[model samples]
Target: MNTSLEKVLVNVVDQHGAVYTVDAMCERSNDEPNSFGDCIRCINIDDEIIKPSLDLHFHSNKTGKVFKLS
Candidate 1:
């Protein structure tokens, strides 16, 4: 049996419900360590000025389902 976990694509959502892919977010961030975790931390910080009010969520590229982060 081929045992492998399905990879779920993570995405960033703005306050206005605008969805952005991780790569796109990293490009817009322009941080030294342009990584998914770093970019998300920066965006989620209280004093985030780059992209304030950003939230992490699960996005399905296949089914187009968006699950908000709680």
Candidate 2:
């Protein structure tokens, strides 16, 4: 029998219900170590792709929890 675990990716959702996979996040910044600018950039890209009207929020893949945006 073959056994393999499926990959679970994080997802971010916008107020309009548009969903974006975290796998699509941008690569890390080599110039700035430990900087989250890349993540924000990725979010912008995802936003452009998903085009959600309202503000965006993060959705936990492991916990299946949706965090509301203020």
Q: Which candidate ranks first by lDDT, i.e. highest?
A: 2
Q: What is the RMSD, in Å, between candidate 2 and the native fold over all Cα?
A: 12.4
Instruction: Tell me the TM-score of each prediction against the true structure.
Output: 0.23, 0.27
Candidates in order have lDDT scores of 0.38, 0.39
Clashing pairs in 2: none
lDDT of 1 by residue, 36-56 (tens): 443442222222223323444
Cα RMSD, each candidate: 14.0, 12.4
